[model samples]
Target: METISIRAPSTPSSATKARRSARTRLPAAIALLPTALVVLVVYIGCMLWTVRLSFTSSTLLPKLDWFGLTQYMRLFANDRFVTSAENIVIFGVLFISGCLIIGFLMAVFIDQNVRGEGLFRTVFLYPYSMSFVVTGVAWQWFLNPGLGLQKLVRDMGFESFTFDWLVNQRMAIYTIVIAGLWHGSGLTMAIMLAGLRGVDKDLWKAAKVDGIPTWRVYTSVVLPLLRPMVVTATVLLATGVVKLYDLVVAMTLGGPGIATEVPAKFVMDHLFERNNIGLGTAAATIMLITVVIVLAPWVYARYVRPQGRHA
Candidate 1:
């Protein structure tokens, strides 16, 4: 057989192609420059400033006196700070799990050819649109022994009824968890509902053909496919957990002898009210460190790993 030599068509040189691509991308980058500048000036600038303040002996205003890690040492020794850390972990785990579970159930129920889907969806999602300030007040009222659950229960002739978790020092944090679940579960449900809707109807048909149970199909099949949405929910919940402040302040005021105190509240109180900005910044630093430590591994696993295609 004679070897056939085929001449390739002429192509642009690498430098010429690179220049052309850069010309196209230059306008897009120019458009994005304003947004980049805003983020650098605002978010990143404030974060650096906050980190700087954490190392200073500031009080009532931002002062810049080198205090080393003295504030952090004080923070580590404080029992209130320790308690706040503990409460945050408990609240975070409970709030996230409660929201996901309840939200999944609600979403699944609503997804079933139910009557009045819009009304049910609205009823659940309306809570997400409302301010936490309002939610906290409603929860406080509902949990109050004299005016809410206990009073109602007692009036029903069960005079010895006692459902005063909001008053108990050990249980007040749980009340916050309950309120947080109520506030967040609605959003979770909406997310899960959207995920459920996007799932292939073919999967359900195949599952039914194979005589697989509906519940198993959900837990094993649909839920696995919804992993991205679940991850989204978890990250959102974790951020909210870190920023837990207004809810606790509104619900319990961190009262009953600092029974339900959380890290955010601890930071806010000392920063503004107690006039101990140094110590407050120290607490804030600890919170930031904790977040970095907890999230770093997950971030690395999720974003910094090489993908492996299956055989």
Candidate 2:
């Protein structure tokens, strides 16, 4: 029997493909190096620094001395901080609810093929385009008792008209809610409108053929389909609720005596005004914790659970 020499097939093609992939990826990796460094240094570094500082008794500056949870103890005990936590909860609830309701309604209205659709969308989104500082200032002027709506109404011989929520200690936080709604509702509307446009036209036709009312169709079919958009809008609105510093600073200054105070403003006051870095970081950490607690469940439901199902 002639022994035939058997040779292994060359692996050059596989090796070449691997080499090509590396070459293709190298430039992209090089391009992303600066962003990775910035994120590691600026964001992660700052977060770690804040957490470390929260355990200290630093005053006027960041001191590396470990002081346990004294700052957190003080944070919870402080009336202003407690009030800020309460105010944020109330404001967050009202703001999110108002935005969802008003935004959904506006989106539905706009989806009706009304004339001047572009103009209406622009007008709705105009507030979001304006900076918070500008929105706050304009709203401040508009809500001012002596100079704004109340004054104008009073000048019209309705001396009994009163709209002094901006000055009332108990009601000042609600004014923040109103301004927040005005600034954020447009964004939610835009998100909802995009979701609406993506819905299959066949679904609308099916609903009509079944003699389902428009509102019923929205409530039954379209609303469920818009879950992802609602989640997106809620997250965006919730983020705005948490970092609610600039609007409150410009509009209310956390007053009528800390009635409208929020966690972000509380952190800023301790860090800068009160010269208490430990307390500031502690407040920030608490805010971070609160946000995580609120968002973790939603994140798990939306992303992690779906991934687990596939796995």
Candidate 3:
């Protein structure tokens, strides 16, 4: 046989391409280093410290003296904490569901290409521009029995009109829900509207050709396709619900005998107002654990599963 020497094709281009890509990304990575460091030091570090302190008997100030689950025991046993947990559940469910429903409807209505679309879009989104503190205060005034809706209605010659939910222990939490919905629905609407706008017009045309009713098309076709948007909205709303402090403070101040108290407020009271750092840290840790428990599965399903499949 004739002597033949055939070398494999060179992959220098691939190597060179990777090198160039790395070189290009170097600047962006460098730029992000400061932010990454800050997040690690401030957020993660503080979280770890808080968790550690939760195991201690710190009061008035942080101390490393271990105390096991004493604080947690007291936390669960406390009526105020129990009420706060319950109130948070109610607020979260109603606030999230209300925002989703109202936001989706608003988005659908806007998608109809009605006249003054800009005006309507702005009107819907304007509330989200205001700070939560402002929204809470404004809604508080509006919900006040003596000065707000009840007063206005009563002044209109209706002696029987009474809308004192803001001060009613049984209904105070629902008032928080109303304010939460108003403050949050606008953002959800904007997000859903963006998703709606991005959808292919061909889908609508096909649905129309099939003689599908609008509501059925939405429920079956359009809404399903907006799952990503829905997920995004849900996450945002859930975060708002979890870290719900400012709104409650500004609106109800956990009034009506702690009817509207929430976990965050509980933590705040323990940490600052009550000078129980141990309890505060324990409450914070509990909230953290609760969030992780609730979100871990969804997060794994949404992100980890896909990446795992690729791996």
Candidate 4:
């Protein structure tokens, strides 16, 4: 006896699924297109335009004349620009380091399950919620000699007290650093606290079993685990350092004879106040280059290198 084989009919479920997926994705694609276009047109386009302007002799009005590296050369030679660059370097180093140290300590303290943890966390993180302008203004008043700390101290019979960094040329940049620490440490603390909270309890127990000192455990084991958080906080702080305009404006206005001038303020002065667009754009380009150079290694290590290794 011969037996015939019977085959089941193919269903259109795959085709139906594909059609459903396409229908669902179309709206999302449509929604994203506008944002994509805006980024391309607004951000990338403006960046390119600014860079192009940097290479021109544009002043007062954008002339678009080929000026080559004249603007950069001029920018480097400018005393105010040089001073601004130096001030920024000082501020960045101190601010980043101070924020990390203070933030880590705060996070560690809070991580001990201390009483009033909520209140302490709120107090620490409160400064971060305030705008840089507000922080700057507050710090400016607090550090003022005649009307602030110095006066208050004098009122307490300490007539020789002098806390005049805001108006003191040599120490003005440090005041900015202090204000930055106040404004930024809170954010860094929050980041560090999150990282600390994410650490496995088993590791702590193992460290305890191994008789590792608390400081050693933190310095050796926990710090290594918190590297990502440190990097994140550094990046945020570095961005703030780069765009440090509002704070300086509110506090010092690049005062004490250009002692606290920063690159962002330099750019703004040239672009708007001084009517030197070429110089401004050149400074802006340098800033952009600096940021790119700083971030490239991390970006490659974090994103590109992993893909290459996987491949």
Give a tens-digit lDDT track for model 1, residues 125-211.
888887888889999999999999999999999999999999999899999999999999999999999999999999999999999
180 Cα displacement, candidate 2 (Å)? 0.8
Model 2 lDDT per residue over 141-208, tens place:
99999999999999999999999999999999998999999999999999999999999999999999
Candidate 2, clashing residue pairs?
none
Model 2: residues >4 Å from true position, as ranges?
1-27
Better of 1 and 2 by TM-score: 1
Per-structure clash totals for the candidates: 0, 0, 0, 0
- The worst-scoring run of ten residues by lDDT in candidate 2 lies at 1-10
- State every prediction's TM-score relative to the real structure: 0.91, 0.90, 0.90, 0.89
Candidate 1 lDDT score relative to the true structure: 0.88
The model with the greatest TM-score is: 1
Candidate 4 per-residue lDDT over residues 60-169, each given as its tens digit: 99887899999999999999989998998899899999999999999999999999999999999999999989988999899998778889999999988888888999
Q: Give the per-residue lDDT of model 3 (tens digit) for 172-238.
A: 9999999999889989999999999988999999999999999998899989999999999999999
Model 2 residue 226 distance off true place after TM-score fit, in angstroms: 1.6
Reference-based lDDT, each prediction: 0.88, 0.91, 0.91, 0.91
Q: Which of the two candidates, 1 or 4, achieves a greater lDDT against the reference?
A: 4
